[model samples]
Target: MPRLPIIHKTQLVASSRLFQVEEVHLEFSNGEQRIFERLVSRGYGAVLIVPMLDNETVLLIREYSAGTERYELGLPKGKVEPGEDLFEAANREIMEEVGHGAHHIQLLKRVSLAPGYMGHHTNLLLARDLYPATQPGDEPEPLEVVPWKLNRLDELIAGNECTEGRSLLALYMVRDLFMRLNR
Candidate 1:
């Protein structure tokens, strides 16, 4: 394995409400130096929940994505609040976006969207044994909850609205796990 680069210093090149641009100065073991710019998120990470309404159906949400400037169809997800557990954040996000709460929830994986250029991480959560519930959320508009069959994930992926990489990979992972378990 190659040695990790030593970070000489990191400077804040830009700042925004939700993200900060950082310039990292580093020196490798070979005495080579390089400067890389990355986006540093300003919160405790986040959680992306796959709330299974049944053995086959998963609850999804359609909401406006500011980055895309349009509505996106994806699994319920939200940021982890300060001092909050990842599972707790997952349940809360589902309740807020899908109007449901999970009786059982487990972390599947923690992933970085763009590890090479971003410091943000999202915890993928698998939620089952769901019940109807709703919590007030900070969304500017009410979200549309859509029940989707895991078997039809290909259709969802082929659609343009399900463009979030984290959501697609999470669903694929859960689908594969469920298929293997049922075999």
Candidate 2:
């Protein structure tokens, strides 16, 4: 196995209200040194929730995605407020976006979109036993809550505008989890 590279230095090159780009200098074990640029989040990590509306149904949200320049369908997600619990953040986001809160929440996994150049981590959560709830959210416009069947995830991907990788992957993971548990 190869040893991890040593970080020589890291410098902030750019900053924005939502992101920070940093330049990282690294030296390999074999005397190879390189400088790489990556993103550094200014806050704690985020949470992506798969809010289950029923045994076979999951609640998704359709919201405008500036990165893709269109509305995308995916699970409710938000940043973890400083010092806030990850599960609490997931429940809060689901309630604010989907008009429901979960009584049971399980951590699915933590994922990185592009670990090669991005430093953001989103903890995936599976939320169940939901009840009607809502709180004011920071979204500029109200989101459309979509109910999707766990067995029809392929249709959700093939026919709908669902495109967030983390949400898609988490949905599949939760579905498989249900399958394994049911068996």
Cα-based lDDT for every prediction: 0.92, 0.92
lDDT of 1 by residue, 1-183 (tens): 779999999999998786789999999999999999999877888999999988888888999998989999998898889888998899999999998999999999999899999888999999999999999999988999889999999999888979999999999999998999889
Itemize residue pairs with steric clashes in candidate 2: none
TM-score per model over all chains: 0.97, 0.96
Q: List model 2 lDDT by residue over 62-149, tens digit each.
A: 9999988999999899999977899989989988999999899999999998999998899999999999999999999999998989
lDDT of 2 at 80: 94
How close is each model in CA RMSD to the real structure? 1.0, 1.1
Residue 89 error for model 1, in Å? 0.7
Which residue ranges in model 2 land beyond 4 Å of their true spot?
A: none
Question: Where is the poorest 10-residue window by lDDT in model 2?
Answer: 156-165
